[model samples]
Target: MLETILKSAFEWRNQLGLLNESEALRIFYGPGESNHPELQHLSADLYKDHLWLTAWKKISSKVLDEACEIMTRILPFKIEAIVLMDRSVVASEAEVVTLRGTSRSGRFAVKEFGVKYLVQMEKTKHPGLFLDHSPLRFWLQQTQKNKTVLNLFSYTGSLSVAAAHGGARKVTTLDLSKHTIEWAKENWANSGFSPEAGDFIYGDTFEWLPKFKKRGEQFDTILCDPPSFSRSKNGVF
Candidate 1:
């Protein structure tokens, strides 16, 4: 089973070049709707030298050993570390399993469509950016021009950066977490954008939405990607 995963990872290595030379890639995604039924609960993503694994259920020690061995044998570069997470647990908490190698405690960058996002592996449940939204980012980069973009529930502001890169006149990012907003600022800076390039709002969307309406503030393009469930002092969304 592990050998099959190794082969798939190796095959997909070249596919990253299709997106960008230096960027994160989903080496394997075997969760729901995956062809590999045996590995239907496993997913792996590669960011620079790091590997992040997530599973719907707890993985056994023997499976972990086999995975480590196969990864070491197939990867051309030195594997810096592997972070494992149980989706059921991490859905509510940010805790993760450091399966192998040294955990990165500082800022790390992951490129996508030439934009760089600064991510902290240990600070949050998500590794700064959501890989599934790469296509949307690419689309925004190609379409936004002289437009105002409003990104609601913007985690680390990856989409906002994309809109800015696409020549949006102004970008506004709103999120509840101050830490994530700061991290988004770092990503903006890393992508050759200044903090002044975009407006970062640290507040609840529900609270702010009505204010935006009352103030008559309108955006040409609005991107709303909220979590399935969220809690705020005023109410839940």
Candidate 2:
């Protein structure tokens, strides 16, 4: 048994007890963990009954099957399904497959601190919510009270929704993807906000930033977190 499996199983077994059925959590981190070079290719996340396995490097089918089998036997959750996502290739070409059970709709609701967000398991490479930013989102929810907030590069508007949920007078979310903008709207609605609760801008942020500056627009808080390997209009694009 690799240390990764033992550590992951232990963590999942214990952590799920602390959270309700509505939450999402990172079971273990391995890819960049200097302590675990033996299986740096893998990491896992828990969303309700499902488990998402992200492979930062390609693993042989035999090894992957073995890993999945071990995972099913040890995890205490209901085991709705186990999803493997390969992050070793181009984002467009990355592979996502189910090794056990089924995701049913490939989408489910995941919560953080009782706040709801939609998880699209197979839509894109991302599993709806970014588990790494759970604290940041919670911070936005705690601090933005009766103020205006701007979330730039807001994929799915998770931060914006958090700000609104915390009583922000207004929240504006800007992103390049209309698809994700709509998805963001769904997330906002999932968090118990009305569809008309906030502003969702679907356009190039570069163009919109200049326009906002020209208008002398201001926000009490601004959140900017961009994806690492994004495609700008041309390259990013």
The top-ranked prediction according to TM-score is: 1
Residue 17 accuracy (lDDT) in model 1 = 60
Q: Which tens-of-lDDT digit does each residue in 8-54 have in candidate 1?
A: 66666665464245467677777633555446778877777888887
lDDT scores in order: 0.79, 0.77
Off by over 4 Å in 1: 9-16, 19-22, 32-38, 90-94
lDDT of 2 by residue, 1-237 (tens): 564555555566476664553368776667544344335678778887788888877777876677667666666657788888988888778867888888756557777876888887664677778888888878887998989998999998888888998899988999988888988988887777775658899987778999989999998998988777576666653
Q: For candidate 1, what is the TM-score?
A: 0.89
RMSD of every prediction: 2.3, 2.6
User: Which 10 consecutive positions of candidate 1 have the poorest summed lDDT?
Assistant: 13-22
TM-score of each: 0.89, 0.88
